[model samples]
Target: MAARERLADDPSITFPGFFDDTAVQTDADGGVVELTGALLRAVEVAADDFLGPQDANTLCVDRHESHRYRVVRRQGIIFIRIDEDPRACGLTVPALHSGAQYAIGSDGRILRRLRDGEPDGSLAPTDAGSGIPVPTSEVGRSFEAPDGAVPLPF
Candidate 1:
């Protein structure tokens, strides 16, 4: 049975429990199980399917008209460096350009936005002006910037 179906059928069965009970066969010697090679790949596939893709870029790409964004995922958050200048393709910091960078959740909600290495005050409100609240725990944490990219100031 598929993992999703198993979870739906049995509310008490966690993902690990489901995997332990059904995903792999135990060794006859001592009932030990090891995840390696094909098994590891299968686990990854199942995880991606169950929890959705880890990268927020796949979720947020459709919202942008340009595909010149660089995505970096760290600690369940996604950082996107948007290249606004058409000539700046493959370049990290466009010269005197007005591109913006964003820290977004895996679910594609904007957490923070930066312009020209500073906080962008012109950010619009979301969810009928209530705006999305930035989680305090997510604030001040340093996310690894993409290669040749400047780190966000948040």
Candidate 2:
């Protein structure tokens, strides 16, 4: 069976086969997808779609100027944290000023969303002073995409 099919059938695996596509090439040594050109653009588009609409009234601030993201697979789930690109914002000190985070299932379904610093109420409280709580399961919360939705490759 294909790797994608095997991943889909294995409930123990949480990382989606989102990057299994013709446009993406995987490195044999580490099995890491080399995202470039069209594939990179597609992933960006997917992230934007997942983020939904933003307020357009800001004067000179471009909310979509750039984004820095971190992806991790742990305990049978994939978590992604996206923050505003500090370098592009020209900040004197490095920091993640604003952004959104979410967890996705192997089926490419978004399980939960944590906007800004607020955690979804269903999440269990972490250790004291650990900041926002981590998601423990699929909460059924999902973003409704428009006509053309791009599949995320991570």
Candidate 2: tens digits of C-alpha lDDT, residues 6-121: 22222232332323433322425767565434334333433654444457763222455456556555554565566666567666544444665555554454555555656446
Candidate 1 ranges with C-alpha deviation above 4 Å:
1-67, 88-95, 117-154
- Model 2 regions more than 4 Å off: 1-46, 49-65, 93-97, 123-154
What lDDT does the true structure give each of the candidates? Answer: 0.42, 0.49
Candidate 2 achieves a global lDDT of 0.49
Clashes of 2: 0
TM match of model 1 to true structure = 0.29
Q: Which whole-number lDDT from 0 to 100 does residue 30 have in model 1?
A: 70
Work out how many backbone clashes candidate 1 has: 0
